[model samples]
Target: MAEPTLHIGRKISKVRELKGMKQETLASELGISQQAVSKIEQSADVDGEALEKIAKILGLSSEAIKNFSEEAVFNIIGNTYHDNSASLNYQCSFNPIDKIVDLYNEKVALLERLLQAEKEKNELIKSK
Candidate 1:
């Protein structure tokens, strides 16, 4: 079996895609070239400044990128330790993207409700 990769690039790419941002757009925002963005997303050892720029552009913290990985914990442990010491396993049920979407939707619903209430109040005042 092969070693698990950190997949920092994949995380960056995923965040960018979720935000509907193109590589060229991110590069332009960071004053870099499209190729630089591409390389950053593909390489695990990208420059710290570049990674910070990517995180800011994607509205994600650096810690988020640090924890990004495609491989499961079991796979990671198996690859790192075969028949050796004890291993730990963990599972994540919540997705960050889903949580973000839910929050945004909730905010929008609240705003709509407030607007409706305000409009009704205005109409009542006008009729008085």
Candidate 2:
């Protein structure tokens, strides 16, 4: 059998897809062509620095992308679900795009609240 680490490109491709990011989008972020991204995805290895940049764009750590694989996923699920006392209660109802949008909105709202508080503090000082 081939070494598990030999499939890093495929792992990157899978995680990119899961993030709802097209190879073209990734290519744009990486300053490479879509064809180049496709080629990298088909290869067994990618450059270390480039991989780190790609992982950041995908909102994942480089190690997460490197270690992600079907076998690993299966192992995690198997271990988590097999314990008789454990319960799997959550469901995935929305697409990844919706999830991302929701996260973005949450961050924006938090930032707006912080900005308002800062403005209030400034006004209080100015009134003194």
Best by lDDT: 2
RMSD of each: 13.5, 13.4
Can you write out model 1's per-residue Cα lDDT over 21-94, one digit (the tens) per residue? 99999999999899988988877666787788778877888777767654554477679777544535544468
Q: Residue 46: error of model 2 in Å?
A: 0.9
lDDT of each structure?
A: 0.79, 0.86
Minimal lDDT window, size 10, model 1 = 83-92
Error of model 2, residue 90, in angstroms: 16
Question: Which portions of model 1 miss their true places by more than 4 Å?
Answer: 1-5, 69-128
Maximum-TM-score candidate: 2
TM-score of each: 0.48, 0.54
